[model samples]
Target: MRAARPRRRFLGLTATMVSAALSAILAFTVGTAAPAAAATRTVNDIGPVVSSLELNKGYEISRDCGFTGVPQANVIGVLWLFCDTAVSPTGQRVWGTTAGTAQAFTAPSQSLFGDFTDASGNNVVQFIPNPSGFSCGGTLAAWASGIASIPTSSPNPLLIIPYVVMCLNGTNTRPLALRIVDYDYTTNTFSNDSPVGGTGIFTGNPLADNRILGSPVVYNGSLYFYTGLCTSSAFGDCSAGTAQVAKVTLGSTPFAAYNASNQSGGHRWLDPRNYTFSTLAATSGGFTPITPASFDVHRYPAFSGSPFVAIEQDDIGGNITVFSSSSPTGPFTPRFTAAVPCNSTTGDGGLCRAYIGHPESSTSSKLMLSYFQPSDSHGNGHVRTAWIPWS
Candidate 1:
């Protein structure tokens, strides 16, 4: 194993001050504002896009690991990926090649490294809870931005692959860390924690640094990650822009170490601000990565209306650009650009203002989002869910 980096520390701001700043950003970014009294939800009949699974209906699920009445507590992000079964259709959840009860997936006990703010003005962190007496080997880096599930094959063996990517200390460099966790639902035990090996997998071609941004998704048997570079650009590196939609297949050969040059789709990297990168979708030949034209905007994208990739980008004053694509990588077109539903003049207080967390589509066509609602600021932040059912 390579020598691990030193533990990162938060400086300049006290925990309270840092927490406050995060809460403010969340308020403006994902927080909720009071909609007009006559407000009604926009319904779309986004026609057939993907396989019609009955799982698309939305249901409110628990966020933030069920910590009620706690300030700065809410689920901020969620991802629903594909899984295959290795077992016969025997009405059983095949867990292992040796076969047993299926392993129930669990969230980590430790929360995100940085402080997050919600619309209602509450600062929060999503953490994985450590069991009473388990000595896990890995360490989570500070201010880590995104979380994704590593795609896996073999439904009969019931494998769990969870990966957490964290940016570098005081920079946006991600030395991508991966963990292959095996959960035994019957015994409720977890093992098989390993660091994703370094820079060897991309064929020693040097995977772009500081490109880890946005949530990750899996399609066509390969795990795809979206690169942001927004944070770096914010720090004044305008020349450093390389947005990427990259993928690697599920195998035991250490994906992070796989040769970047050996992969298909050509590591489609671009400028996050200059060009738009669509999420990866499976194609007949391989995977397709879509790019949008200038004067078009797509931001905070999530799977919506089943099979359709949806994004809402802020346009010129009072306008928001919303786009949808049936194919993950696509010749995508625009849906509409409309006024934001929430008012942003005087600023909404509390964590409730941050209503937009990470948005995602479950394999069953259901849409899930982690954002702060009206009650989130004073320990009332909520992780809410909604659905767009199309005939």
Candidate 2:
């Protein structure tokens, strides 16, 4: 998780005022109106060229812990955080990277610090330190599974806001909980902002049974969350349940409540309410079907001039497909496919999962992506990176 340097705030004139000034300047210079150019939509298929890097060696996994790196959130231009899992220790931990440099060939250095934990060193949900109560009173556990940072254009870039998905225990009855936590870069600390929508569980909510995946995409002051429902037969396989996408306003109080009645694909807002959930629709105005697997969505920085990007994972096949969409919820256009390198001969069960990391914080034309290979008799689980070309 590479931390980003602070960026300059834009306090210029409003868009309306700038437009008026531009009009006046144009009139004085040309003395006549110029024809406006029509917008054109051109889709490109020149996908990114993937390659292996040495950065994986920087992540140190303890023998007792079995720490496996899972890329969780990218605080655009700020830092990268991994929602890592420890098998032997049987807990979750977060790891961070130093400031990221625009290096195309080298991997960024990372460290394991700045994570939420209890006095005894057990992993606990960092967001809600003093929770009202846990579903079960035994040893409680939590992880910052997924996170998305607020845009720099907001009140403060230094005030990093991330939505955290947590699970009490690895059971069907105890579904994952979504909550928000504030991370201050200046002070290097976390503040529990409580669960979104007042209560952690939605009761009869459609997404109650599903797990929120990847980092949320913040667009126009709202955060969009992608979710998938998994089956009981096979763990981590979500292909059996219905897939959905939901959204909530950034600063809404008590969070926003979901409206089950108004279930449309586009902007299904229930007025004065704070949030809404909708089934993804295809380009032909039909349901957008998806397989049960992990996926990620992100908003490219303005400079990139790219649409919202999504990387859908195929864990069984060990491949990842990239898609682009003009809006968060849409008929996403598939662009390219990349294979995850695996060494089957070593036989640690040979598994690979491609996880898309933060793209907004990378170079203008490149995004950071990572894949993890679980440890075999040879070594511990390792994380590797590939620079995806966006432009």
Candidate 3:
């Protein structure tokens, strides 16, 4: 295990402040404001495009572990990561500090990708609630499997995690219904406490817009999330040609106690089916975002006045682009864009997709960005990261 980095204290905005932020975001995304203008894009040359020596060297076996859509969180200073999995059809979870040198995969597989990704190591979430009390490891759901914990801030004793579930035997209709699963941290094993609300796994054609992408951003009591085009399914194209951002207003909608349960009073998370939302491009940016973009935001302290940075990939998946906003809500003007090349001759020429950022490692000026190569041919779902500088 590596030494943990000193943790940063996350400042939660008060009700009044959050309201003001939302209003500001609304002003730019909708109403009477003119659309944000696009900035002229330049070639990638801000700094050195370096590979994540630690992570790529740590995981990614054939047909497994190294796929894209990498989501992360900083729990108690240790960086927890969950990537797309296929080898055993289980969650690809790992954790470490500074670098991902810790053992993370649950089973050992042959490293056919010719990378030092894994050989079976310690793969539980770094922060095990209470081994003597609750079982964090167990059957996540019956017939349906739950992905790793979605990123969100917990304000109460009960940690509310939004889980993306997949139904087995071709029964999954709505794969995007993020379930607010409760881990029995105070129990002897995980009770799989799924709160009653909008809905869960059921058979039928999955709603085109049912699935929400990426870890959610919680601000001012409401849970902020976005729906994207479904890339991996046999059902109808549930993805919109273009999906905008939306929030699940905790005060109303969904159900009663929505606010209080999610860390309101100090709790948070949303039904994800309905709420108020807007777009990242209307405020600014040269391009409009689309599906599998993995829209995400981060709060950086050194960003002068604006503390938030919006992350997504270019429409063609050629560069990892960003926009800076005052808050989680936006008026997000273009901040930076970098070209991370993809081999056109190899594995579907992924060219890069699912560009995301690491809130735990990014700085005001120097940003930590990552993306994955499609799981085609020899590439077999490899993930790479780089440090991009702000201009």
Candidate 4:
């Protein structure tokens, strides 16, 4: 049940069609309120109103990272962001730049930051490599981590995004680092904190090397996370070739604190000891996809008239799945499924956060996915969208 533009029509209509497409997702959707009038048009025909919410066109620091959904709409001016390192942090390792100045690029020291506004907005950045030096290829691939957003402080109710780097340079054996960033209103910037938490691998924690892939989701006022084993055998694993889903709620000290740990022993919950992450088996129809070394499971539970969890499965195929969950921690059942048209193979590369949009005054939803073609260098990728009807 999908629609494809005719070759001839697609070529001629590229510009005008894009203009018309804008009508369905432009500045009419804001305040989180549904349209007053009932939708009289079919899902495909009805035009959606894009909310006033605009992505800060801050610089894309990573040659690779981008977020799915609208969790970052409120960020004003230039937004600061970070991600795992796929390549070495040294400047001499860079092959070359596609469009920008090559010398302007430097390796991310402990982490990297960028300034962005709406996609149409101008973004500026300066990369300064770590003095201690780093040890990755000149590629920036997606690594495993557990991402969550929590309130920064009282009175302002600002949000802070936390990332637990359980793997380094997309490899499992690498040690983990706990990174935190506080959003400041006065300066419209983020202040990053380092290595607040350390792993117990040396202390013989079996789960120490297992990589975490999912972001934070709220259920009954508590926070939950999804985790899985690193594809690379270098990391420690309780079980090989299997994934584990778990839940960890914010403790009493829910807000961010200096030198404080994000997880307490009682705060984390496992998947009933019987659940596994690979419910969707690998495709067996003679598809020679590249094998992904690592992946993260980002879930979008249904809301606003939709009832599916959009899981962003990176690596092989760069595909995404929509699952239905009666409870936050499944027994998650699979439902609708879609993938980026390009790079539907399980090769050495990976993709993250395929974006999905639920528009106002509409019965259908839009899914935006991104991927890099194997032939490209630096893993430079592009984004595409698909529309699915509610009826």
Residue 337 local lDDT, model 3: 57
**lDDT (Cα) of model 3:** 0.33
Stretches of candidate 2 off by over 4 Å are: 1-59, 62-77, 85-132, 151-176, 195-207, 211-214, 229-242, 252-289, 302-304, 343-350, 376-379
Error (Å) of candidate 3 at residue 366 is 0.8
Model 1: residue 296 alpha-carbon error in angstroms: 17
Please give the ranking of all candidate structures by TM-score, highest first, separated by commas: 2, 3, 4, 1
Alpha carbon deviation, residue 314, candidate 1 (Å) = 3.3
lDDT of 2 by residue, 1-391 (tens): 2111111000000000011001000000111111112122222222121111122222233111111121223232334343333322342333211111122222233233333334653343233242334344332323333445554433433332333233333232232343445555544566545433343223121123332333456677666655433342243333432334545444442133221112222223221222323112111121133333555666666324557766655444555556666776655655556555533222322344435545543466665555554443244444445555554
lDDT of 1 by residue, 187-241 (tens): 4344553323322112111122323223334455554443322212221112222
Measured by TM-score, how close is model 3 to the native structure? 0.52
lDDT of 2 at 157: 34
Worst 10 residues of 2 by lDDT: 8-17
Error of 3 at 243 (Å): 4.7
Q: Highest lDDT, which number?
A: 2
Candidate 2 TM-score to native? 0.56
Candidate 4 per-residue lDDT over residues 211-282, each given as its tens digit: 223444445545554333333433211112223433343444443222223324222323233322222221
Off by over 4 Å in 3: 1-76, 86-160, 168-176, 182-204, 210-213, 228-243, 248-293, 344-351, 374-378
Off by over 4 Å in 1: 1-153, 156-197, 200-210, 229-243, 252-308, 313-322, 336-370, 374-380, 388-391
lDDT-best of 2 and 4: 2
